[model samples]
Target: MQVRHERPMSELSYQVSAPLKLTLEAGQIVTIKHWSLDRIDYPEAVDILPKSGLLSIPFQGVDIQFFVEFETDTQDTYLKFKNLTGRQRETLAIFYRSILSGKMVSTGDMITSLDTPVDLVPMGETDDEKASDTARASPQFLRVIWNVAFYLILSVVVFGLIGQQIWTRISQVSLMHARVVAPLVEHRNTDAAYVDEILVAIGDEVQRGQTLIRLNLPEHDAKLTDIRGRISAAETRLQALENTRQVHLNTGDPTRRVLLQAYNQTVASLNDRNFFSGRDLDDVINAWHDLRDFDDLARLAKGPFYDILRGLDVEIQAQNDALGRLKRELGNHKDAMDAVDIVATTAGTILQIDVFEDQYIARGMLAITIEENRPRMVRAWLSEEMSQTVHIGMQSRIRFSEAGQTRSVMGTISDIQASIDPDISDDFGIIVSVAFNDMNVTQTRHTFRTNAPVTLSASKDWADFGSLIGLER
Candidate 1:
């Protein structure tokens, strides 16, 4: 390493390994000078004697001392130098060679200094050892780099595989527990009657207009039968009256025939004449009187028979009116009896059967409950916070767990309740309804006892980081 200095002349020291053969007189002084190639502002000078000497060099306003020692008593002269301040060791080596080569003059003129230059070798480890050490460390450095790259590739592959398994596109949404239910159609009776037969039972599928139960109303049936009998009897009596009247008309009496002829002639004359004046009106009155006289004479000739016939006709009319009313009552009674066979008004599965065979069911009593099995719906209650994110028509996933198995189905939010249910707990959740995409309750209708517990999840575009790691918010 090269050391840089900011001073004009810096102190440098080196140990001399070779001996100098000099005929030195005692107390002779030699001057050593230092020149800085980079700085020309100041040159430094130091005076030294052979024995032990101390020299000061000015370096950036600070005086640095150099200690030099020479041992002449030894077989080889040893020179020791100390307190080097600058890193220009090569310059110091050259200066040391000038001394050995006689470039440095002795204070006495008798010793002439040579003007030749020489090179000084520095002391340290050889170049071969440095090359060997560098060669040894190169493989280790390359191995470290290779290991880092290998681990980086391995981490990429490992995390990529793990991400493929766990980092799915599925959104992490709050799951709301829901229930599966079909539309319910309640069957009820309008009149009190005994359950004659139950055509269907719970869990049985029924179609529209299919009979679900049969009720027996004996009293209503008896009333209907009695009304029919009374109607029949009334009709027979009316026929007899008609027959008697026809016989009376066919039988000829001389007084009755003469009176009837005179009445007919009088009525014909009255109809033919126009009573436009007082004389015409008098003639009409006369004709009317004559007709009334004949009618009275005819009635008198027929005597008690005619009176009986007239009374029979009045009685028959009254009986006919009564018969008509009775017939209407019978028809109404028959309709009431027919109502005993309770039929389903819609197609669905029978969720409940309230009445059993021979059971007495009262008016407006529940018979059966049928639930429409198509287009299955799931009702979910979401928390108030979660409900804010949910909306109608959003896609949802429904999970049904039963018998140690879980099945998932896709659906859409069909409806949302306008208000929160008062009966629900303080969780403060609103009800949401979902409709299955293509599935119906018919396939798994039996699985729903009342309301099958389900899990509802709506799809979201993004999720939080904590949720992905299974952390609760």
Candidate 2:
């Protein structure tokens, strides 16, 4: 809050010795070697770099000038020598000339000064070329030195401008990175049925786990018919024998009556409930029938004579189960011709269907896709350097290229590492999640279910810069 200004510092000597012609730019801090306040020959002044302010104070045995930049009403100045060991109040008073000049003198009369005095070599050199004219014409080596000095001065000015621009560019920084995806599900039981016929062509809408196609077994019907016929024949013969044998038994024929009656009763027992003597008669027909005769009649009689079947329904269930397993296995083949039943796995609008019903498909085929529900989650990783700067409950903005719309979202920094990549990785990035904020897409199209990539930007901490802006009261 205090105001002060720089006064030029010079290394005083009666002789003018501008050796080396080393140049230092404005605002750059450089060391003055071979010069100290302790030297009598060097006097009390320092060789200040151009544009720097210096204060002279009596030190040890000499008046020592230390470099500093003084502040005016509201501007900043980098005081070169932060701390000084000279007499404090005396040195402060001597450098207070500019402050007094501004307060006491009129603007037109006051001397314009800050860095100009440093160009004067205290060893008897001045900026006025006219005053030094007599000195300039004296010697051949002196003329040469003068010309060299002028070239050296021009060179310093040229390089300084270039160096400043280079520094500014180097100070600029930006951030961007490649995205990492979180796979929705690791594995799936893709092997499934297709009962409802898939109506649309490829790229048709299909929900997750929705039934798509139905598989049919053309041979299932013929086998059903043959098993039924045998059951009916067995029952009819047993019935006729039962009526005749009972009458003979009454006429005193004991052996024939026993055999005939036993047969009729056994037939009755077999027709009880499609479970004939603990055996599946359908299976029996299947296993023992003639392949060429085509057992349609027997299979057709199944329901009517179901009561007389064998294997007690277990064998029948086994056959059905075996057929089911086969249908499931065929789904893996892209060239499957069998009918099937496919169902949707998740709740979503079907996006597309790649294949049609009655069409053969192969294993691991792309059937269709679904665009999932809302409140999409986007993830990003921050560098280890920013781990501390970023924290939970920070706000972020996102813009999707396809949608061409902006979205404002709040983020909760769930995790942060003490160091980058604690182990496996050489570079570490902390994971963060950005939750959507009241942002809705009227347009229905989206790239993927919940995971959509978009450009992102983060708000940085600007408290220090804010001080310069007068935001902090």
Candidate 3:
């Protein structure tokens, strides 16, 4: 078999002296700078080229008809003939060789026209000039910028929400079981007595210095009565001594009256002494001896008047001293009587009454339990996992139900401990004590119970957010 060789078509072009006007479909006019039998060349007018079109060229007073399509190469923009018959190709060849070659195309020369309407399908928007036009029509950069910004903001919001949830979970330590507690003020009786009257019942609100119970203190009462009796007796004895002295004054003997007056003055002076020690008593005895000497000197004339008066003066002084002592004792017994009434030392509500009317109570026995009228506190148990996170003086939030409504208050971690409470039977975890803030105290003063349930929460340090998410070492 013999291999037949075929010839490839030649690529040739020619420049026109004057640009010829070529009109395409859609009235698109382009200036042809170069011409050939197979194609025509023009400056790039649009980014996308028309795929195919029917073209007509006027040559030798007859029109040569063919189909042409746009194409491109490295050097120039041009169109190539397509869908041409052999006869149409030969006609164009003849026309190019004889008349169109080296021709200086002018406005009066051969005119090219497209017959069928060219569909302007978009190819691209990359041409610099056409792209500028498209940009002016609608800004693509701004759209891209806005889209990028929207996605950025959306990402930030999503991360922020996730971070908030994680932070809320880790920043707080919960107490599984907690209660609203207040300090218990125990009212104990220091002296043994019988409860004469129960003035206040359990849960009754009492003010400071208000009597809660009256006791029948038999020993104290007996001692008080005895002191009163002694005081009365002393008063009687003192009045009797005064009467005896008045009797001596009424004797009407001028010398006897004068001597009795002197004796009374001396006794009054001695009675003025607050405390008489052995030496002071000895001095009084010496004064008495001196009075005896005066009496001895007047014995022959006055006949024992001075002696009788001196003895009466001494008796009056003894009654006066006894009255002073009994009165002082009475005053002490009166003070002890005040203690028989068990008055409240502080304002509070009575929690427990251990004794009833006529019940005998011993010294140092708890008579009543009073809950002080003060701010409420929360006692909670923290888990071991949160032991390190919770500490004293940390800020906290406490919540508890009151009158079927939930209420929250700001508080502080006043105390945290691992010790056990002897009063509590169950082993609650680490102890946590929370004190309400001053503003909340006023609102919750009367609302708190000794063992009401409560919940506690605390704020977190934001710098530890990364660590909670495992994003930091």
Candidate 4:
């Protein structure tokens, strides 16, 4: 006896009870390879019998099998299938059987089941039973979707509420360059006076009437003394001449008495303090000429007596005129000496000193420059466009940074230049001034330096959205 063995293409194989033969007709059955879903072989109008007296059938690379079974009792042919894997067996059964029985199956249904192989059940489950299981699984999936939707809605609500409280403001921002400025007062001297001492230095604060420099005028004082000495000598000579005239009057010569009395009356009128009001020295000189025509004195005194009296009268008149001239010169010297000390006219800080100690300063020369320290102001220049909107009394903020520290002060717009300055560049536009408030005045004086750079911001009166909404209510 001889035996033969053959291997099936896949794990699944079939065997019949005895040798059987079947007749296959065209279009009666189709054989589809499950893995490739291709019709590898199909039945034709031919007869198939067990080969070599065996009742086994072999397939190539087939995971599922489909066959048309004829039931003799019912006289009906139906589709059936077998598969190796439990997953997707029922769906594949229905799908393949529907094709064999000529029942229409949508391509979408076949593709949908093929795409999701896990949705198919084992071979024993019916289509109605699979539907119940699918219905049972839907609640868990829906709950997961609801949870994701709830989180998304919560996030949107939270962000929307936060955005309502936040605000955004749009403003015109600009950089302002500024400096500290104050009113300046200059003290000067014009006379040729020497600076004996300087009492104040730069950066020193001084009060009103404070002495800044002391001056010495040696030449002026010496000239005054000389004028006083000359006036004293002239006065002494005039007094001696009056004493001599009194002696001549006591001698009782009638002619001499009349001449002497006329001379005395003229001298008395010339010496009177009020004499200069009506008659100048020249008028007194003319009166002396009339008094000199004394023929009677010449007759009374023979030789030398009339000559000596005439000489004495001329000497007295000359001395009195000299004395008056010297006295007027002395008064001018006194005034010059009194103007030596230079004092401040106002309270301020000393900015500069032009003259040094012991230096001779001419009259009308600048000695020191003092700036009023209080009421400091910041000066800035704005563009022509910016100038139109800026006005007096607008709120202002000043910022200054130095040595790693920043300081700020509040102020108000005090002035705006009516016209642009010709000396400054046109790009600088118009000059604007801001006066520091009373509370910050002292702090500004201590922290800010003159001509130091600063930043200034001027705010406009505009309502925000919140404020506008509040106004509506």
Question: Which regions of candidate 1 deviate over 4 angstroms?
Answer: 1-172, 200-211, 218-222, 250-308, 339-341, 402-405, 418-428, 440-450, 461-473
TM-score per model over all chains? 0.47, 0.30, 0.49, 0.43
Better of 1 and 2 by lDDT: 1
TM match of model 3 to true structure: 0.49
Local distance difference test values of all predictions, in order: 0.64, 0.42, 0.70, 0.62
Worst 10 residues of 3 by lDDT: 108-117
The ten-residue window of minimal lDDT in model 2 covers 13-22
Candidate 2, residues 1-473, lDDT tens digits: the string is 13433242453212211111112334433333221222211222444323333434322344445454322211131222333333432333333333344343333322222222332235665678557675644688888999999999999998998997765334311123413232232112144433236543433445555554454333433443443454455455555555544553355424334545554555455555665455646543433333313335445533333333433344445545554554444443323433234455554455455666555555456665544443345566557665545555555555454456554343333334444433223565665555555534323234324435555555544443454355763
Candidate 1 local lDDT, residue 376:
58
lDDT string for model 1 (81-162, tens) is 3333333333334434554454542323211221223344677778997787777455778999999999999999999988
Using lDDT, give the best candidate's number: 3
Cα-based lDDT at residue 161, candidate 1: 89
lDDT of 2: 0.42
Candidate 2 error regions (>4 Å): 1-196, 199-209, 213-341, 352-362, 384-392, 400-431, 440-453, 460-473
lDDT of 3 by residue, 1-473 (tens): 12222242355554333333456777675655555656666666667665665555555455455656656644446666555555555545554544434453343323322222344568776679786776544488989999999999999999999998876688776665677877788888878889898988887999999989888789888988898888888899889888988897677446544565665555556643432433345545555666676567676645556567778899989989988988888887777767777889888888899888888999888898887877778887766566767778888888878678898888888888886664442664578888888755445656775687777787656665677677864
Query: Order of all candidates by TM-score, from best down to worst?
Result: 3, 1, 4, 2
Q: Ten-residue segment with the worst summed lDDT in candidate 4? A: 50-59
Steric overlap count per candidate: 0, 67, 0, 4
Tens digit of lDDT per residue, candidate 4, span 259-339? 566666766767566575665566456555644655544556644655667777888888887887788778766766656
